[model samples]
Target chain A: MKLTILGCYAATPRTFTNPTSQILDIKNRLFLIDCGEGTQVQLRKNKIRFSKINHIFISHLHGDHFFGLVGLVSTFTLLNRTTDLHIYGPKGIKEIIKLQLRLSNSRTNYGLFFHELESPESEIIFEDEKVLVKTIPLKHRVYTNGFLFQEKIGDRKLNLDAVQNYEIESCYYQKIKNGKDITLEDGRIIENDKLTFDPVPAKNYAFCSDTVYNEAMLPIIENVDILYHESTFLQSEGNLAKKTLHSTAKEAATIALKANAKQLILGHYSTRYESIELFKEEAETIFPEVLLADDGKSFEF
Target chain B: MKLTILGCYAATPRTFTNPTSQILDIKNRLFLIDCGEGTQVQLRKNKIRFSKINHIFISHLHGDHFFGLVGLVSTFTLLNRTTDLHIYGPKGIKEIIKLQLRLSNSRTNYGLFFHELESPESEIIFEDEKVLVKTIPLKHRVYTNGFLFQEKIGDRKLNLDAVQNYEIESCYYQKIKNGKDITLEDGRIIENDKLTFDPVPAKNYAFCSDTVYNEAMLPIIENVDILYHESTFLQSEGNLAKKTLHSTAKEAATIALKANAKQLILGHYSTRYESIELFKEEAETIFPEVLLADDGKSFEF
Candidate 1:
């Protein structure tokens, strides 16, 4: 799995800082998240293939989260895109996009499908053979949802030596790998656990942003491999953060700690701070494995 | 009058090039024209004060022309702007903006007034004491209008020696400046022209973009001091330009020549061209005094 941070600043985009956008590549699928303004330029600077983005997920109706969506859709039409583009966001997103397209008189050459999300509870929003995506309800000024992308558990690995010792036929190897007991020719049964070893554990990532410090999402994102939470302010500005319904670095760390996430990534920083290091310094106090999100940064697992 | 090119490239914004956007400073009023995506960042990079822009003129509803407007409006609200913002655009622009603002539940602290235009003929859209803005209808794939900014004639300057020779009171200077013939004590008439030369002939600028080779605007923009016309393609791609309803560099120069404009500025270049010098080379063929539009470049007239 790979993740690329296109932009991570909060409130407004500046010459050096962008608002909020990211690209996640999991199981050969490229998913775009929260396309703020100037996202297309960022994608060009990062040299990411624009055609690879098939799915887009938006957290809320804030301009910093979804303003770049219509531009991207229009650019897709200009580029003669033929692949169906799926967009998942809160209700009313479709109207905003359709209105702009109508005014411009642009008809997309590809199918633009919108899956409006309105559920207030945790639910699986997308699932396939390789991955599953679920919504993590978040508390914000507007209706918001954070997405949790998890890889599906794979098949068990067969122990060739153990299978050979048990005189198991080649045809039974598939059953053994599927965690099923194998029957031998002598009417003896070979246990699946004895012939096979467990596969690598599934890895999962959770993205939460533009929300206040809330513990309701702890159970839904429990033990996630990586957690990206918004830290719009430092610990010193906790009051402002609370007033704005945004989280401080310490608050994001507390949520990561409570959820037992392996790694915590902090982003969506307010431009008032001179340096991003302050966020890392504050988050690391509670979560040992903490990283600060920077524009154009990439992480692989 | 000063003009700053924030972005001039056509179609999608790239890492090195931007879409259509400009700042026209005339008569102490800063006017933003055609805010494409990334315009706010460009304004920041150009060091233009965002608060000074009270009026915005959108030439069309294409994404390359007005995609950055909503973000700018949202940023204004975030910055606590109280000055009323006036926007002039097509008939459907008001609905597009209001719907997005309504969906986000953002009520602007400042008033946002929209002036919709659907006239096929030229008409004055805005007029103040020092400036006048008129629409120049253009032929494009969409309903579009080009803006003509003209500086209103100012008070005539009184020749100090001539006024003193006539022993004119200071109170009467205002009337003389207003082009009134001052009555002499001996019943001898002093002509207004003898007192003051005509205030610098009112300078006018015509902005035409995303249009084809249309001569209908010649009379409206006749003898303009500066003319900015879109040249999306070169002469070799005349067929493409004709099909897209866009002008070639040659066609833009032809319009400037026919209009008898003092100077011609070419912009809205297609990304297919490797160098901008090609546009200048082609335009200068028809109009000798031609300049290429470049981002961050400023022109004073």
Candidate 2:
């Protein structure tokens, strides 16, 4: 899976800085997360096709997190998009979007679906044959949830020599690759494990943003391959974080460390901090495997 | 009065190209016109303060015309702006904005006023002592109107030579400048022209965009100092202009010529034409005083 950081700045969008927006390319789909303002322009700059974005996941109703969504949806209509669009966010998303479309006299030719997420527990919001996604309920001023996208383990590769000696039918060989043993034509029993190699390990990506320091999410996103969490402040501004219910860099790292994530990506920096170096330094104190998220940056795992 | 071109490109926004958005800096107030997508970014790049712009005028409901409005308004709230914000646009602007705010639960901290315009006839929408603005009804796919911003005639400047001869009270000097003859204490009648210089001719700006060739507005916008009209296509793409209800370069110049404006500023160009020489070439054929408008390029008249 490849994750493209379309925008990572925190709070308001500035000339040089952008707000939260990310694109995850997994299972042949581009999942947009938290479309801040200028997301369409960012997508254009990254040379990503607008139609590729089939699903959108918004963490909360914060302006910085989802202000770009309406414009994107409008542009989709302008471009005459026909594919269905799915959006998962807080309960009020549908009414808001419908109102704008109503006022503008704009009706989409494509099917638009909304899945209002109000569950406070870890629940699967989306699932397919290759991937499963669950929300990690977060603590914030408003209702918010982080997503844990997990790629399921695939079918194991077969040992050609074992399959040939077993003389199994080709159709039965397919079952063996799925970790199932089948009886041979000569009545010789062959175990699936000896004939097949282990399947590729599932890779997991956890996205947590616009939230306070909450260890409750660790149980759901525990030991993910990569974790992206909001770092809205530094330790020096810890009091401000508490007042706003936003997490500081140190707090984000603490959660990442406790979750035992392989790598931690810190983003959603406050507008007050001009440079992200302070965020990286603060996060590294507790979580040494910290990486600063930058707009237009990409990572692969 | 100064007109700053914040963004003047047509079609979709790119890193280097932007949609239509301009700032008219007249006296104490900053007025915004036609905010397309990425307008806030364009404003930031131009180093314009958000607080300074409390009044925004939108010509239509097209995505390329007012898509950036909601984001800019939201950004103001995020920045904790408490000043009153006013918007004047076509009907449905309030619903579009209110829906977004409702969905995100992002409401203004200060006063928010909306003056929706649904009248098909030209009318005075804004008036102050120093400025008077009216709509120039236009024909397009959607109900649309172009704005005409004009500076009202101001008080004349005193002629120091004439003032030395007359024992004029300083407070009454303003009345004399307003073209009223004032009698001096010594029983001498001072002609208004003798005591004061002629008031500076009122300056005016007319905006005509996204419209087909129509001469009906020529009389209303006649003798304006400067006129910025859309020239979306060159003579080569004039056929497209007819179907789209947009103007060609020649068509815009014809309107300028008929209006008898001091200067014609042509923009809203379709990106298909790589070179602007054709636009200038076509417009100058009819009106030699025509000027091509560029992105972030401003002109003074």
lDDT for each residue of candidate 2 in B146-257, tens digit (9 for 90 to 100): 9999888889988877877776768987787788998878787878888888778888999888789989888789998899999999877878899988999999999998
- Local distance difference test scores for all models: 0.94, 0.86
Q: Model 1, A207-239: lDDT tens per residue?
A: 998899999999999999999999999989999
lDDT of 2: 0.86
After superposition on all CA atoms, what RMSD does each candidate show versus the true structure?
1.9, 1.9
The numbered model that scores best in TM-score is 1
Worst 10 residues of 1 chain B by lDDT: B193-202
Per-prediction DockQ scores? 0.85, 0.56
By DockQ, the best candidate is 1
Native-referenced Cα lDDT, model 1: 0.94
At residue B76, give the lDDT of candidate 1.
Answer: 92
Interface RMSD of each: 0.7, 2.2
**TM-score against truth, every candidate:** 0.96, 0.95
Report model 1's TM-score to 2 decimal places: 0.96
